[model samples]
Target: MKKYLLLSAFATLTLLSCNNEGTSVNNTVESMKTPAMENFDKAFKSLGDPQNRPTEEEKKRNTSELSDRRKALLVPASKELILSLGVTESELMRKTGGDMSQIIVWATQIYMKKSDEIRKNIKSEK
Candidate 1:
């Protein structure tokens, strides 16, 4: 009787866990169809136009917030990292931080990849 009770309890927990996971899987599938990429492309193109380049004030702020030397060091490394992640030049630039677009891009890729990996693992388990 004790063995039967333990098995039933284990089965109950497993079913409840799967039930909760069903909602998350459904939500992820729904979100995958959202028009987020369109919005991102629109915003990215706007940021790339020459006439829309950062203003003098913005440059000054960036320079002050982040020294020129650090910015120079990060920019190329950031660009390479973003490229590796398949992000476009315009998209990478749009995610700038003070003067550190490269670092920002790298960090963004890291986070996004991490989230994707986690989601993949969850799906695999399911």
Candidate 2:
């Protein structure tokens, strides 16, 4: 009888532990989502959608707009790096107009690659 009781108790604890783990897994999944991540996902999805594709005529106009958007997002903080490097941000913008081609044409120009810490933070989100 004692052995039977012990076996039953062990089974009960095992079942309880497994139940707790399932709850934790559900919580983990729920916690994984954030507004920024949702926006990022949506942005990529829209980019991939066939309806969003641009024509050759739209390329120049769209390129300028995209460049402005990127500069607006990044140039504010990048000013210090730009100034310290002794490069004129305005002229750079005027010349490249936000195109990545500057890096290829002027191989010596400063290029900012994403840092490892940034990569880690982005990776951790998912």
Candidate 3:
């Protein structure tokens, strides 16, 4: 009976330690957002707003085409997000020829790649 009690106590302690470690890892991952990640998240979420979403007519029209005015609305946010990712304005302009669509696309790709790296790091740590 003494041996049984000692074994039970050890098992309980081991399970508790494991649960705490998993919680700590989860909290660490949740708090690992960079400024660039936040900027990209905010920029993408802005598109979900009612005013930013395309209207039915717009959907029926050239759905892929963004009017200059619409592009202008997103340009500042896109620039901020891209710049946060360590690209200089001059380099961005040179690479994209000052095109808003190219800038947004490049920023999105960078954000996705960064996110992938973070996920891989978390998995490796686990």
What lDDT score belongs to each candidate, Candidate 1 first?
0.58, 0.49, 0.77
Candidate order by lDDT, decreasing, is: 3, 1, 2
Give the top-scoring candidate (TM-score): 3
Worst 10 residues of 3 by lDDT: 66-75
lDDT of model number 2? 0.49
Q: Model 2, 26-64: lDDT tens per residue?
A: 565435534333333344345445655554566757554
Which candidate has the highest lDDT of all?
A: 3
| Model 3 C-alpha RMSD to native | 5.1
Cα RMSDs, all models: 13.5, 10.8, 5.1
What's the lDDT for candidate 3? 0.77
Candidate 3 stretches greater than 4 Å from native: 1-30, 65-70
Q: Write the per-residue lDDT of candidate 1 for residues 4-98, one digit (tens) a residue.
A: 99999999999999999888886775455324332332434555557555667677676544344434544554455455567777776666643
TM-score of candidate 2 relative to the true fold? 0.29
Candidate 1 lDDT trough over 10 residues, lowest sum:
33-42
| Candidate ordering by TM-score (highest first) | 3, 1, 2
- Candidate 2's C-alpha runs over 4 A off are 36-126
Give candidate 3's TM-score: 0.67
Model 1 clashing-pair count: 1
